[model samples]
Target: MRCFIFVVFLSSVAAWSEPFRPWLIAAYGDTTNQTDRYQMGNDNTVIDIYTNLMWESGFLNVSTINLANKNCVSLFKNGYSDWRVPTVHEIQSLLDYVNAPGINEDYFTSLPSNESVLVTSSSSLQPTDLVLVVQQQTRSISSQYPPDMNVRCVRGPQRTAPLDRYTKFQYADKNFVKDQATGIGWMTESSAIWFCDQAVDLSQVWTPTIKALFSLFNQSNSPLIDEAVFSLPSMLYLGSSTPVAGENGYLWAIDGSTGLFQTVPLLGPAMAYCATVQLD
Candidate 1:
């Protein structure tokens, strides 16, 4: 009886020691290069051909499974089906250990896009995916000031006219210059606001609120203002990078004149704000 018990214990230990495997694997046609274009999906939802191929032909299936939809989850209602929306935690886990050397580069290489790279943290007990979702929710809240607070105390009047005349950077004709100091592309204010991608972090591109943009103009050649910047909606940012093929992306702009922001769908004219740090 003692020996039988010992054998069972050993089996349990072995099972526990085994590493977990992801449902998907890298199949043929998956490429890490960002320049090559290829077709994905069977046919119906045929989106544009991507430069890199993240072919999903392995143990796991890669379908657009919307976790928010009960019907979508119902489609995979079975044991060991091995398909679901990647929890924010799972996505983060993929990001954390993925960049390490000697890891399975093929798996990371086969992902749909570079933006899908995950960043996991050990401090949180919750799954990385859940953590990400919570963080995003909090960020969204912070972006827009709370409605319950008294508007007069927090709100201020918008400044009209260009705060100051400053040189703006133009990306149109491939006129690019590498600034030795901050490494950011230098440009002047076109309107009151000067919209551009954040050089420090590309994942989060920012646009200055009209108030903040005006402040920069006020500073002019003296120095830029020092404050946290806000971003336009994600749809606008994505549309700026990729041309809006079919439908225009929607965004909400705060208009201080009316004290009410308006939601509008747009294909272009989204902007970002920045500051200048003098290095001498």
Candidate 2:
């Protein structure tokens, strides 16, 4: 009896122990395009690929995949169901300190060859190239642009710094000198002007195209403002001790002053400078 009980306990434990299968089988359906198929390279899978690549490249620990299914809040895979669509903060985390590994362009390029077997109710047709083309287009548009500029035009009235020195304001608990950084209190079409609490130490911020920013903002729900903040085209920030003029390139500040600045690829190298005002 004792051995039998022990065996039963072990069986119960084994039953409970499950590994998380982060990957989910997703079906692509387009009623308008009349395209439906089980595509391997979808948004969720793309995100997974990025996550995996980043993790393998020593960028992250937990490989979390964002599920696109609305019906599934969270799913049990690999013995864990703590998975859900990443919050704005979580998505931001993925973007944090994202340099070297940059975007996994190679992963994107190789997607066509990674197609999985089609699983569909419609036996009349198999997945078509049109489906892949649509997916590729969507991804191309999304990955090509930055997130800041996309929402700028949609943002309400341009709150230009009427005065040189503006007061400081707080957004999401982050205090910022007003008007100094185009980043401060600027409105977007969706909401009022808000400052980013988590300002990067970098001197400039890059404004991506309005479309890019909108998609990223909507998808990630990041607290970082889409309008006004000076984001570096790439992720290069200068310290206060660094010389401002001619050291790197000239950056036009919010106060209409052009100073020496460094350029990074993250911010378009050609259009690098952004307006940053001095609060003090």
Candidate 3:
């Protein structure tokens, strides 16, 4: 009886584990046209071939919020003038969980150990005036006034040459995936978890694009499309397996949770995913 019970328990656990699989099955490829995958320019800027973004090699110590805003645009690096502070997601992508400094050390050699807080352009949920900040050492994030924070400027892919003509995807971080083909990066974690067919609540947080789309028609529908920085994955992007109860824990798709093509809820507790175009 004990052996039989153990076998049943093992079977139940196996049945319930909802494993995640990426939609694109092809192994990520290399940059076709770039001379090197990573290139350091004349100034303290480095280019990322995978995501096609240019990053400042180190953090800039700005004591005040006004300075942080003005710092990036004021300087010309490598003859490129269009530099802006990175978004919260963009800065977060630099963190490497397996390594110290949480970023790729090879490309970014000038990072300072004392500068812990990096300011982002994203506003926080609480008290909308505050900006988001990322803690480098702890890999934690908080939203606060940016009176004293470091600023790192970044620019989109360069126009000098073709970075890559074909589509490829690379893991920016555990939570984010970068697609070179579409030049879009996706967030893996869902905002909320729910069963299929649950109605989305309208009062929760959502990007303006998501809010507008959901206002029209949201259902277990077909032919879904993605827009802007934050939205759920489409059912088409979700794998072909139908979500099984007690298995395949629900994630908000482009529709309400449906077995087939669906859109994500505009506002709901359903697990939400985010996507953004690569700066380049």
Models, CA RMSD each: 20.1, 20.5, 18.7
Candidate 3 regions off by >4 Å?
1-37, 109-114, 123-130, 145-147, 157-280
- CA lDDT scores, all candidates in order: 0.22, 0.20, 0.39
Error of 3 at 199 (Å): 23
Q: After superposition, how far is residue 52 of candidate 2 from its true place, in Å?
A: 13
**TM-score of decoy 2:** 0.22
TM-score of each prediction: 0.21, 0.22, 0.44
**Ranking according to lDDT, highest score first:** 3, 1, 2
Judging by lDDT against the true structure, name the best candidate: 3
Where is model 2 more than 4 Å wrong at Cα? 1-74, 85-110, 113-280
**Candidate 1 regions with alpha-carbon error over 4 angstroms:** 1-33, 36-182, 186-239, 243-264, 267-270, 273-280
lDDT of 3: 0.39
Give a tens-digit lDDT track for model 2, residues 1-280: 1100000000001121223221111101011111121123322232232112111111111111211212123333333333322221112212211122212333323113221111111100111111101011111111211111100000001111234433555433433444331333321212111111123642332232211221212212132222344332322232121112223432211111211123232222233121132211
Q: Give one digit per residue, the lDDT tens place, for model 3 in 6-103.
A: 00000001111222222121112211132455678778788765445677886666666557657766657887776765554345445542346645
lDDT of 2: 0.20
